[model samples]
Target: MTTTTTFDELPSLVGTDLGYTEYVTVTQDRVNLFAEAANDGQWIHTDPERAASGPFGGAIAHGFLTLSLTIPFWTELLEVEGVTAKVNYGLDKVRFINPVRVGSRIRMTATIASVEEVKGGLQINVDQTVEIEGQERPALISRGIHRFYA
Candidate 1:
């Protein structure tokens, strides 16, 4: 479920854990499209036959492809009631901890680490962890910054 809040309520949400999103399966089609778009057609991410003998044992999604999921995953976790615009300011830090093989399921758990008032808007720093189902380590860990305009 999503945590609903207004622009005025942001300041009170520091340290609040917003919980996890529903699991999403990563597919070979998604990885192939990402490879084409990014011009990063590495064997491990695009060529299934060759990737079967590669390090991760099969074709895997690019780390950036997994990181991009943070956008959709964030929407599933929180909703701001009074905002004219919402912008992904960017990420402060990120680490691709583990491989996300094609067909793996992933989900994210997020926390509001801090909220600060910026000119004409609120700037939020969110801590996010994207975990792979049945896996020990998360696929990605990141600190994402966002700006919400009133």
Candidate 2:
């Protein structure tokens, strides 16, 4: 479920665990498109035949591709109401902990680590973990920062 919050509600959200998004299956097509768009057609991410013999047993999504999915997955967790704009300020930290092979499913669990009011907006820090289906370790973990303009 998605949680919508207003500027006034920002303070109360500090240290809140927003929870996980719905699972998204990572397909070969998706990996190929990301590789193409990124101009990073590494064999392990595109050529399935070659990749099948390589490490991980099959084509795996690029680390950056997995990181990029964070945005879409984040929207499923929370939305800030009455914001003129919400910008991805940057990520404080990001680590690809596991390979997300094609045909795997992933979802994100988001937690609000911190929130502070700025001049015209709020600086929100979120800790996100992208988990591969049935996996003990998460595919990726990141600390994402956002600026929400009122």
For residues 17-120, what per-residue lDDT tens digits would candidate 2 score against the true structure?
A: 99889999999999999988999999999999999999799999999999999999988999999889999889978999999999999999999999988889
Misplaced by over 4 Å in model 1 are: none
Q: TM-score of every model?
A: 0.98, 0.97
lDDT of 1 by residue, 1-150 (tens): 999999999999999999999999999999999999999999999999999999999999999999999999999999999899999999978999999999999999999999998999999999999999999999999999999999
Q: For all candidates, what are the clash counts? A: 0, 0
Say what the RMSD of model 1 is.
0.6
Whose TM-score is greatest here? 1
Candidate 2: deviation at residue 101, Å? Answer: 0.5
- As a whole number from 0 to 100, the lDDT of residue 128 in candidate 1 is 99
